[model samples]
Target: MLRLAWLFVAAWVVPALAAPPDDPLRSPAWPYMAERYFAGQTVRFDAAVRVLMPGAAEDPLAVPVYVDAGALADVREILVFADLNPITTILRYEPGELARPSIGFRFKVQQATPLRAAARTGDGVWHLGGAWLNAGGGGCTTPSQASGSGLWKDRFGEIDARLWPRADGLRRLRLQLIHPMDTGLAGGIPAFYLETLALQDSDGRTLARLQTFEPVAENPLLSFDLRGRGAVSIRGRDTQANRFAGTVAP
Candidate 1:
């Protein structure tokens, strides 16, 4: 009887392993991305953390992306990447205690690839959400539009930002800066972009930090949630050792 039960278990498991995966999005790049990004964590494609991108990127240079992991609680870190891009990482965010899991930004897409966001909770599990994007390619390989137009040259390191109070006492911050953010994939162009940014309060206490990467859209864009309505400053640096500092008041 024991032998028969073992055989029954094996029969059920073998076919299940042989069958195709039941991933909701059925992402073709999940296997490779899993090994590259999350090798040992429990991961599943969950709709609760929405990763919204257009079906087709009309402009590969600047494709808008929205990641809303607001439904999840105690999110430790969030990672945004493209599976097939030359430079995969777009943003690595830590919500910490003040901010929400939702963000709106733009990025570069090399070609048709899977745009993914993985949110890790306190439980040590990474929740994944993504969708395939269709593109004609060349977002990474071309010179930045801002750079080509020479606007970023005159306005380099200029940080323009706004902070607004919400009905619930939270604050919303939208920031833009002028930078080439070159990926270096394009011929003769060296990579130069904001490497790190920290959001801070009046006392210089760090609210949160964001790790920006090469694939992030040129003329860097960022949206963040502030827990308090107090004055906050955005401080950052680029690859060339240039410093950026700006204060936004309520």
Candidate 2:
């Protein structure tokens, strides 16, 4: 009876695995969306922020922020500061945002916060995108999942790379490794992700440098768009000296 039940479960789950990826509604992260946004909330998109404070601080109180238009065409609801919080709240839509919608403004955050942009498409569907950032080190100073000293000694020379193809001959490349990017003594967990990513062309001219952290979602999927006509090499070294390397061409 146990064996029969196990087979029954596999028979149901196997077909689901064979389906295509990119089904946003069925994704593992999908549930988090509904938990974040709900009915009657107006969705905000492509917002610009202006910070009215003493030197671009991330504090919620002092920062003055809002969308550009007062009454959007089809706006159903509006949600502000859906990213980092003990303070995120939904600004619901009575009708919806403008028909040909776009928004921009300035705001302050005490630290880098994750920002979510959602649109209720013409087909009555919801689309979502997000950006994660730090107002400062409060999030970066969290504890790490691995140990210092030991992971450091063994992680030397470890490297991993992934190349994702994009339209218009652009390539998105990410390279990461298993090292405790320790900040020399402070030693925070999630705080220990890489602080900078430096990429170079085959000839060694620098291409790009990215600011990041462990909250960057494990193994560090560093992505950037680049144009090149030859061999490209990528390498990353964290504050803790954890290094990774890879090469790809398009």
Candidate 3:
């Protein structure tokens, strides 16, 4: 009876294992798309870096993505991209000496696509990680309802930051910035959003730098990993050439 039960389990499991993946975003066509975007650059599949996102996006306009490269040492920068979005390249992040090679942010998913994170270490190898997110559509083309009349008249560029201790002895810093992040896709709205952000310590030592694009959602929210506990500050510049700065306490 036990032998028959074992055979029964294998009968069902073998065919399932042999079946092709259901999501088109995870299909073979993604590699061709990635190659086109990289433009002859080498990308190696490495498990050291991980991209985390929901299997299916609940909200196409505000999908959360996390890239964790803590297992990799001496990482210089991490580049995030979505294969099927109108704007493929998401953000480029350069981590400082005391900063961890990890970042979390909310972004717009144009459709079902493979989201990738490439971490370039000191040795010059681009280690890649990816995740597939399924969405209905219209993440970029639709106008944001949050950007109503006079909504950002006085509250633009405001930042709120906080630090929370993690279980692994690493600190997580969360930051929220007020910005329109207009993609210029909506009628009559020109592109107006934060383009650059720098994180530094109280003594002015740079921690991390971020180059962002219009795909980021309205009122951008970001999170980073810190090695130790201390006060930190952030400075940013928008496409309009306006600058803003704020500090976070321990």
Candidate 4:
């Protein structure tokens, strides 16, 4: 009877601790995240959707991630998030006509976590890609660089952004926005960051849009790929309602 009981308990524990079936990355948080975020939605772990990052983060507050879903067709949206972060949602990008299915940005992390990207194609299927990071942790609670000094006031809304023509016939737009991007988790600090940035064509038609959250690092360095050869403009507003705009000629 004792041996039988131990076998029963072992069977239950093994299944409970195992990763969900068909998870290639084998993240321990994938099961909970599946129902919490992608509940009732069709999600697939696809290799064509690539999420690239360094093996270890030198600065937890500025871990860089680059996602390229160019191999997937008719991608409608792409989302990047950390599974175990206090603020999970990092970025939401919709590249309509102005860009390809590739983007790069940096975000903060509280601990070693699974970083994933979900790219939804027009067929109503969501494809996934991700990688795990080895980090030192404590990135979300640190005071921002801008908060450590009054120097942020001198260059709060400055934008160093431009569009460059690539040899592969794709126009790449590289932009950097100067903001503290405080998560407000630190002592006596407030949460502030850029809310939304829109890319528009010469006719003022919105080509793509990116929505960011507090997990993004200070002075966001962003990149996007364009498929057309027309002039485009970037417009955005921060949490304080400060406006920023810049134009790029293709």
Candidate 5:
């Protein structure tokens, strides 16, 4: 009958329309990134490398994220990325021999997306952790703190480093840098930030390196674990090719 034919068509069409589309975050793009970054190796889910952030970001421009890999030893590097941001890779940090395996920093969230952290071990395995952050939007394209009148004129290109003693016989190294970190999405603001950072010992041996992108918040705060050290020094350069350095003794 005509009624039976219509019902059959409706059933087929409804299911097709209702079926959810593939998640773009895990599509071909993710595989390509995995191949490039991890050399196509499998990333295992790990609870030790914890990615802690708020369920909902109150301030998308300055959302705080803490990556704790303190329990894991022999950590070579840590990488952080956002699934929905225009620039997917946010930060790449290489911890030093005596440096602690924990870091805390702030970043911009464009929208609701998965923020992932990968901790690479000495054996070349990457342990992954992720969390979702719901943002109200406009975190990337909005005006920055440096865009304000006269804010960046005198305060730019400054570095501060400090070392503190820990109960575990390790030292905690904290570094802060003054930079605008403009994302270029905002009107008339070119992308500018510290692109590379390195820590070294008194003998000029490199300890660890860091690579950062525009998603980093203005005036980045970085912490690292440090072992025995007489004097530790840091050197870095920004997008404008401005070099800065600082030293700390514990």
Candidate 6:
């Protein structure tokens, strides 16, 4: 009967449509590998479009992210996002009077997965850039010596100014801090670190703010340029609100 034929077609189509494609984040193509190898993985997408650029199987880059600012006339800050690690979002850099429209930094990738960098323009619309990694290592799990105990009890770090000129009177500064920036808990050490750092000038302004973590090396170093010049100061704190302050002379 015609009804029976239609039911058969419906059954076949329904079964086919019910099954979903395998997800690359959790269960990658390399099935022979261990599952923990792909654990804590994440990728970036907007409206279901994956933004990461896939590299050749033989490529050696650990993290790959495309940064494009040609779409906008003015840009604000480039926000980097990665969901696979303990800390999903990586870094955010504020351009702040810099002549360059695009920039990039070398960060340690924690896994073989997708990474994203998005630019927020003056108009407030966010644009995206992304890359993929082929190896796995938890940067957050790395160790630092100064994280805990009474050994560094009074050894807090310091910085001079939040923003200054780059010696050419270009309004740049060298901001410093004193902290162990512990990668994470290992043994008895605490798993504390600075997740973000920023500097604002005399006009109640922000010159630059960096996204930071244990993988950012010890005693984090950040230098940036601002617009105005006059008795500049800096205020920075880690996830624990441990403060690092400094001033620059005009």
Question: Comparing candidate 4 with candidate 6, which one achieves the higher lDDT?
Answer: 4
Worst 10 residues of 6 by lDDT: 32-41
Question: After best superposition, candidate 4 residue 121: deviation in angstroms?
Answer: 0.5
**TM-score of every candidate:** 0.87, 0.38, 0.84, 0.89, 0.82, 0.56
Extract clashing residue pairs from model 4.
none
lDDT, residue 25, candidate 1: 58
By summed lDDT, the worst window of 10 consecutive residues in model 2 runs over 91-100
Q: lDDT (0-100) at residue 10 of candidate 4?
A: 97
Which of the predicted structures, 1 or 4, would earn the higher lDDT when compared with the native?
A: 4
Residue-level lDDT of model 2, residues 47-162, one tens digit each, is 33211123333533223232322223343322334344433432221211101122322232435455454545454544444455345533323333355335655654465666
Better of 1 and 3 by TM-score: 1
Better of 1 and 6 by lDDT: 1
lDDT digits (tens) for residues 1-250 of candidate 5: 9999999999999756543333333543554455556664547668788889999999989898989887787999999998778777899998877566678889988888888888999988888777778899888888788788586768787888888888988777888898888898998888888899998878777777889899988888887777776888889999899998888887
What C-alpha lDDT do the candidate models reach, one value each? Answer: 0.85, 0.43, 0.83, 0.88, 0.81, 0.52
lDDT for predicted candidate 2 compared with the true structure: 0.43
Judging by TM-score against the true structure, name the best candidate. 4
Candidate 6, 1-250: lDDT as tens digits: 9999999999999746544334344433323221222232222233222243445223221233334443455767766655455555556666666323343333444565555555666765555455555554654554554654566657666553344356554664555565676655346667566666655566767666666654444555554545566766666678787776776776
Per-residue alpha-carbon lDDT of candidate 3 for residues 1-250, written as tens digits (9 for 90 to 100)? 9999999999999866544223333655565555565444555678788999899889888898999998998999999988778877789999988789999998887888888888999988778888878899787777766567577768878898898888988788999998888877778878777899998877778889999988887788999998755788889999999998998997
Tally clashing residue pairs in candidate 3.
0
Cα-based lDDT at residue 177, candidate 2: 55
Clashes of 1: 0
Error of 3 at 152 (Å): 2.3
Q: Candidate 3: lDDT of 93?
A: 94
C-alpha lDDT (0 to 100) for residue 150 of candidate 2: 56
